[model samples]
Target: MEEGKPISNIDDELRQILAEFMVEVIKLEELVEVGRKFLVRFQQALEFLRRPSIYESSDLVKSIAKANETKRVNAYVQAGCLNAYDSTLSVGQLNTSLSDLHDCVTKSKSIIDELKNLMDKAGNALCMTSDDQLETEIQASEAIGSEKLDGVGCASYMAVIYSMVKQDYVMQEKIVSSLSFKSSSGELESYCLMWSLRPFINDDIIRQALKQVR
Candidate 1:
């Protein structure tokens, strides 16, 4: 920003609001779709396992548990929060659900932070492309930056059933195969693949998956 030039013009301010609003709308719609996935997954888990989570010795757990135990998972504790993973099933499953929720939360934070950086370019008399164009670009930029929350949350949630709590070979494979859980880009690819698969993942599951994400 120039010393004499203003930090932002009225147009820039309006465009920023519009851009963020559009992003929120797209996010909400995607969330509604993703929410369904959790329901389906939880139901499947309920039917298959006949249990929510397998008991494990907290002593044998990884360092993540020690760290995570301190930070409260924020999504399911609220009223009317129908987390697919947070069903009244098992304590073990709840942990996995929390992880799933956290995965989406982390991805959302990344995208929102990226948007903040992108918005930084819009400062000081920045001329925004029309809303249509801006929307497309924002989505494009989001895809480039995000694209993983959907998959990671879903895949990892299932993994919790096997890898985290249950250690059930059959269910673990089922979860992996169900989601085709390959993530070439590690975390980044994880979020994208999940996002791409959001429509098919079930609504409740999607919502639970997105619990941790902002």
Candidate 2:
């Protein structure tokens, strides 16, 4: 960003980074498409395997239910730990009031409790098979795609941020500082980007998509 730097050089470098970021975005889209297809096939497999007679007689249903429950708990615990890390950063660097992480975790647990209550009611009202649960999960996923992933504004902004960060050390520091200032309460909002994106990242699919691009 220095005045003396040649504008053409800067433009060329920026264009390169922009192209790379767009390629990444395209790979992500392809990964999402493959993941959707995988999910559909997985659901079909579950449906074929979870016929009423088979599901009632076999332990597979219970095993899957338990596995899903464990997965959800592990996800929540990981999220809480990440939140704690963010709070640590805030307290250590920003000299902010130490966040009450216990309270935050408790609030998260309360939300889970409410969801469990809803699930219980649904379970009582209807017979739930693993296939049915798979369908419900797919529906919930579609809802999330509609609610959060529907917007490209955040993605484009992120691409800009990525390009900025790929610049020289001074520029990166300035960019981070400016972002922190623009963020709420001087907190580093950028720290949450990768964590927020964890749910959407499919490493295997991404790898395959990248291979295609290469």
Candidate 3:
């Protein structure tokens, strides 16, 4: 009976640890969803900023600028408009969109920070050897293996995805911050292309991650 009791206690402790690990996995999934939402918001703002015609002719942009007179005055002066009302109007719309994009990027930074902390906790919980090293080793093929990932493998996979996403977000923030009325068409085109390409983020890995969650 004594031996049986010890075995039972060990089993219970193992179960408890597994439960905690599962809880962290669920939390990670939830945070990933939230990060997805923020990414969409930031993408929308970037798309709007990319297309001058869309914002320039947008009644919504006009309404937003009209609601904020200070922004209108600042845009007109900073854009270096002389007497062309149409040019001033376009510049005002651009400024408003840039401001919105900046806000989205700022919000995304907070989400990324939260995700980084969560990934660290998850890695520690899984007793991973080294989060930094694992991040580089774990690839889409490994993440999408036929067998289910062990605790350490799962945590490492998530860390890799998080690192890529964080890098992509940093790149996006830099691009958005660099945009201005003085930016040439070529620069704007390059910015749009880079955003669309998303060089840092691997689509296959993200798809595999989603599959794991499902």
Q: All candidates' TM-scores?
A: 0.25, 0.27, 0.59
Q: After superposition, how far is residue 164 of candidate 1 from its true place, in Å?
A: 30
Candidate 3 lDDT for residue 43: 45
**Candidate 3: Cα lDDT at 31:** 43
Q: Which parts of model 2 are misplaced by more than 4 Å?
A: 1-3, 54-214
lDDT of 3 by residue, 1-214 (tens): 2333454443344334334434444454454444344434444444444454533566885576567669665565445423356545655666666676677677667767766666666655544557776566566338448654544455656677677777877887887778765666666667667766768877776655555554
Candidate 3 collision pairs: none
The better candidate by TM-score, 1 or 2, is 2
C-alpha lDDT of candidate 3 relative to the true structure: 0.58
TM-score-based ranking, best first? Answer: 3, 2, 1
TM-score of model 1 (CA atoms): 0.25
* Backbone collisions counted per model: 25, 0, 0
94-113: candidate 1 lDDT, tens digit per residue: 34543564454444445444
Among all windows of ten consecutive residues in candidate 1, which has the lowest summed lDDT?
160-169
In model 3, where is the ten-residue run with the lowest total lDDT? 10-19
